[model samples]
Target: MPQGISTLAADTPTLSAANTGFMLICSALVMIMTPGLAFFYGGMVRVKSTLNMLMMSFISLGIVTILWVVYGFSLAFGTDKGSIIGWSSDYVGLSGIGITQLWDGYTIPVYVFAVFQLMFAIITPALISGALADRVKFTAWALFIALWVTVVYFPVAHWVWGAGGWLFELGVIDFAGGTAVHINAGAAALGVILVIGKRIGFKKDPMRPHSLPLVMLGAGLLWFGWFGFNAGSWLGNDDGVGAVMFVNTQVATAAAMLAWLAYEKIRHGAFTTLGAASGAVAGLVAITPSGGAVSPLGAIAVGAIAGVLCAMAVGLKFRFGYDDSLDVVGVHLVGGVVGSLLVGFFATGGVQSDVKGLLYGGGLDQLGKQAIGVGAVLAYSLVVSALLAFVLDKTIGMRVEEDVEVSGIDQDEHAETAYDFSGAGGGAGSRKAAPAPGDSVAPAAKTKKVDA
Candidate 1:
């Protein structure tokens, strides 16, 4: 355990009521991030697929919650089996765990700790929905979430955070979840997209986001919730570290947003709302692991670097021919890498841990360790995610039928649409129906002459 943390006897109650309440509030804040993600992803997809995109995120809240309570927690935070995984039955159903019992090194009850971790589990899989967007079968996606968390997320979380976990034992620093959440999900997103293939009209079609306002709303909520996500990782407010993480999270996100806008104006000729929102998320991902270790300026550096790098990275799909619908691979995976690696250069000791980085005269030691952690997690997540996706694709079929996709995934998959245009006097009551994938209207028909 880190220096200040103390292990209490099993029967002792060292719980602080104030800290417990704060953690619960933070858990609720983090819980809102899934819906925020839904809106973020929903706005990026075509109007026809909006509801399906939202549903993909919503279902994770339902599915992962149940699984977490049953056995997910055990596999993630239970007794360590090897350095790779936790014992599957140790904390099964949270059995034998006392509500009043405090987790080691924390003033909050174990139950609060369990529930806070549950929020992390919920949002991690939801992050992948952006990559698969319009083409996946709803059933296949739900199944994927269940299975992916089992094989990929649970083990990886253990490796990063569980007691006796390999990376944790190696003194690898992931304050919140740069490795376990963002990088893991981003790599998994890539694996799924590789197998499921691109959207029907990926590059050829103009697949612009349907609503910028909704995207902004989601981004705002994510920003609001991320304070909890980063700061709450401390598990208690007794120390001043939580405040440091909190400030770092805010400044990093702000710096990243500005960097993204600047990049957009220079590259695309206009500053776009999409760029700003994506930049904010990129910063959030980047700072998640390093916020507690770096100074405010270091946070800015990390965020700004992530913002610029991820902005450029979003174009990689076009160059490489893979379609990451909402730039999940670019922003999350790439941003996570930027933040995790930068810690080796910017970690100032006396903030969270007693460690210094290269710039602080710590030399190449910490930098090399960061590289090892990043490489191990990325390789493991990519391989296992690809295998899982391949098995599902071969057995149950990962995508919807071509007709269903072209017409609309929302109607076919969920029998619902995000926007109802039936009330608009556009002639037909159901004029909101999407155009067929390859359908084209005559130029004359598409053109509407208006009185000037």
Candidate 2:
């Protein structure tokens, strides 16, 4: 639209292409993490509801993709009106936003950027369902995700990444998504947990993972995908920012793993697989905000601190009696806060603004800014998300019928089984299930045998 800024300019093509390519790859990477999330969450719940948990994440691949193309992208990245929300002028319904436009100044297609961002939009809401698992109906959950994205996720995205977002304007540095993804999902998770109430046997039963292997697999996938997520934020391969982020990602995660194992061994007498996975995730969350800003050493500190803090926070659910089923709030929200705040202190090499943090002898100014950003993000996300959740609950009836919930939504809503090796497949919709041994395997074996 401006002179000397042709969408087809040579430099523009390179920069745009890089941005587009990286983001598209990141989007794909993020999508895989949902299944990873399924595994991560599946292992945390009782075997009976594992498929249902996995379904929640998978559904986003369909729902959010459609929504983002239709209106979600416009609301998030379209022309800014008042710095709160976007307009439809940019690219509504995939109009005029072609590959050339995508690499307008970057290296990839604009579609790539949109699609990559779409992956993020889709997964952010899925992160919250863990808290509401084994309770909500699939239809209700679907409706809620659709509504919540419109009300909660979109606005927050606008505030953080959109052209005139308040946080962006305020100089809050989220290299990836400390406030946008982590804090927003974490706070909303707490809201839904309150609305949905605890799982049937949350505290009473020792609900072990249906499959530890699945959990480990999910953790591995998430860790891999996160590289795309964090490094891709740079929007291109520029000045080794991506490499720095890539290395920090591993460093912090490793540090967190060790810290968590150490703490668990000291406190619980076991270095649980769950602890290692959780620690990796915690480290990832903590480094997300400051990955590009801090040194590798700084990342280790962030990771270790996040491990200890998140481990401590997870216990809070039990003490306070809120069922954050998969520790989304503890790990994402608290870890995000830690990273966002700590970056102010540990930042070096002039990676960010002129501001230096307390540890850097810049005193408390930067730290105060970090605190303000955290509070603002937390408050905005919590209030908007709660309101959105309440609205969805009232309009569509958020929770499923008690019987349907108890039976599992895979059968009740989708008439599907995640695993179907045997022919006597699990039946549909809230039927009373006789307690069978080996909850995860028998159904599949019987289904396969029947099929044969």
Candidate 3:
């Protein structure tokens, strides 16, 4: 539904079965991304934390779905209020709308739009779990997801894509969710990590990824699913805009992957698999916003630029002393900003709207609009997410006790380990168990800082 793109205003009343079917497939594709993200983050953490990492991403599927069905759709897509939020009694619980009711202006049914957007709502918070990996208590993390989405994501979504969303009203062009999703999640990741504090041994420990294959698999799934995440934003394929977006998405991602591998080879003396996966995601994020508005060549430039930038940006955590464990801040935050801003330069004025980029001779007008969109989402998400984490930290606590963190958050948090140690054909498979709730403790190594 894209908050504002599909439902802002009603257009042709005639329903198109083809668009409806296309959207349903896109919705399913978007749903696959959450699991893909789980695998990606799951593989990036140390062996001890793999299950906990995967759970963090997976839990959003359960929590956000319930919330979205209840009031998330209304708060985000309902009628506008002061250009800040939305509300519609009918949308609550998704109970009142008829099955045949079409989205305000699109060819698909409202139910289809709601489910599609539900997938977006789910993944946005899941993206934040990467920063807090290996530390946060599952329950506290769950609560944070519930609260953060209600306070931050819902309103911000309304602001960017809602019918009267301030950004939408301002004519800001967010073809997908550079501002709403990537920047929103990235800023929130930065915010929550700052308040929650660093993971133990964040800098000094080698902390290498446990399984690059899993990371690559997750990246592949994310890349494959993103076509739905981007092209489907248009809500219909009646025009060729959706088709253009699909091509650009592929173009940017490939360019970014190559650029990142090139950079890694030059800087680290090898073309690491992590670099390739990260670069691919960086390109996906960059093209997400600009793909619908730019040419294939422009997409290549965008992806290549984002690739190098994010590859360099990932090292910032080591230098700046932030524990963005999975480079969410680097890939998503930086890629989103790069993509959102580039629209002001590469926009061709022929695809999505008449607005042209500076290079296209549209002057700086569109650039200013994009800056406003980027700054607003970044500032709001950072401040508000920090506040949410701080409140949770003070009341119920966010991180687990030091020993649980050191031993493994997986066992303590979920009562299970990701892999069994027993030989392949053994009884009970030597399952590891969680520590008793009030067990004795021993001191482990203290957290440390190191240069990249």
Candidate 4:
């Protein structure tokens, strides 16, 4: 989630307690993002499917954490091999890594770095859940996550941020996870949705969001946690780079929200709460990759462009006839691209390195690197995710039954509903205790609604 590095600074390698403490806080912030995302996506779906939507994201916190402890960190950040992947015996079970040893000479311990990155790994898959809302089976989704992260996310993280990885060697500056997280997850979402197809009533049904307030709450939490996600990418703030990233993150997110609302007013003639939430997310995504290298002005430009572009991109699903239930493809994929590519034009050459963007007298070199990084992650994620979903669909079935989906997926999948609509007036419709095996209910009695 932080910027990738190949070498240590020339100063002494002594550790700092302050840096270690700062990183731990950042790691916690990043960890909160998964629940934040759950709420955001949960609020977008119909009332009947709210629990499923939330569970889709919340599950990643468990699945990815276990996998990361097992081998995820090693595959992503261990010793280099042929510039394609990484491995180290010490990183295998994390038992070999000493608690006192600093990570690659940074002030934070290896455990802190590994856990911080673990948060990134966890949330990346969670981001994809937004696009597959309402229909997919939870067990299949969990299996897909385990396979996808091992096959796709781990290697891509190596390529983008591991020491001596190809994209890292190419000098593609990903301040945070523009390529490894956003683009990777967004592309995966697109691929899986393509395989699974649309919801029961894609274009015809009234699938309006059930809770705008919850969506807004989630968006606010994401914005707050992102300060840590972006700023902590530097690992420590001794050099003041982290401070700049923090400011840029705020600036870009604000700009993107305003820009999205403006575009909405002109095009749709209304400034909706959904648009505001989506716009803020777009700005956050766009600034993630370029924040450490760009100025506040550049961040504004990045946010505005991403807000407008993503707003327009969301509409493409309707025209092209893909589902993309919550616009993950439109927002994260497009915003990641805008931020990653814009670094070539907006980079000031003073933040992270001496390299300059075109606006700062550098040539088109960085732009080419950014493009390669984007294309590589996009292609790998899309193809692999599609294949994974297809295989699972063929073997275990990804989508629920048509009638189950049309009525409600939560009852069939989770045996639970998000809300209990049966009145609390103690009427006949109120839920009664389940009858014993030998007992029977009256045939004319109405089925009472109760959350199991």
* Model 1 clashes, total count: 0
Q: What order do candidates take by lDDT, descending?
A: 3, 4, 1, 2
In candidate 3, what are the lDDT values of residues 190-232, reduced to their tens digit? 9999998898888888889999999999999999999999999
Residue-pair clashes per candidate: 0, 28, 3, 1
Provide the TM-score for each candidate, comma-separated. 0.92, 0.87, 0.92, 0.93
Of candidates 2 and 1, the better by TM-score: 1
Q: Residue 117 in candidate 4 has what lDDT?
A: 94
Q: For residue 154, what is the lDDT in candidate 3?
A: 95
- Best-to-worst TM-score order: 4, 3, 1, 2
The digit string of per-residue lDDT tens for model 1 on 153-233 reads 999888889887899888888999999999999999998899889899888989999999999999999999999999999
Evaluate all candidate structures by whole-model CA lDDT and list the values in order: 0.90, 0.79, 0.93, 0.92
Question: Highest TM-score, which number?
Answer: 4
User: Could you give candidate 4's per-residue lDDT for residues 1-452 as a string of tens digits?
Assistant: 34444454676466789999999999999988889999999899999899999999999999999998889899999999999899888898897998888898577889999998999999999999999998899999999999999999999999999987999888888989999999999999999999999998799988999999989999988998999899998999799999999999999999999999999999999999999999999999999999988999999999999999999999999999999999999999999999999999999988987778889988999989999999999999999999999999999999988998888889998999998766566766576665699887678856689999
Error of 1 at 436 (Å): 27
Any idea what lDDT model 1 has?
A: 0.90
Model 4: lDDT of residue 383: 97
Model 3 regions lying over 4 Å from their true place? 1-11, 425-452
> 237-276, model 2: which lDDT tens digit per residue?
7557788888999999999988988999999999999999
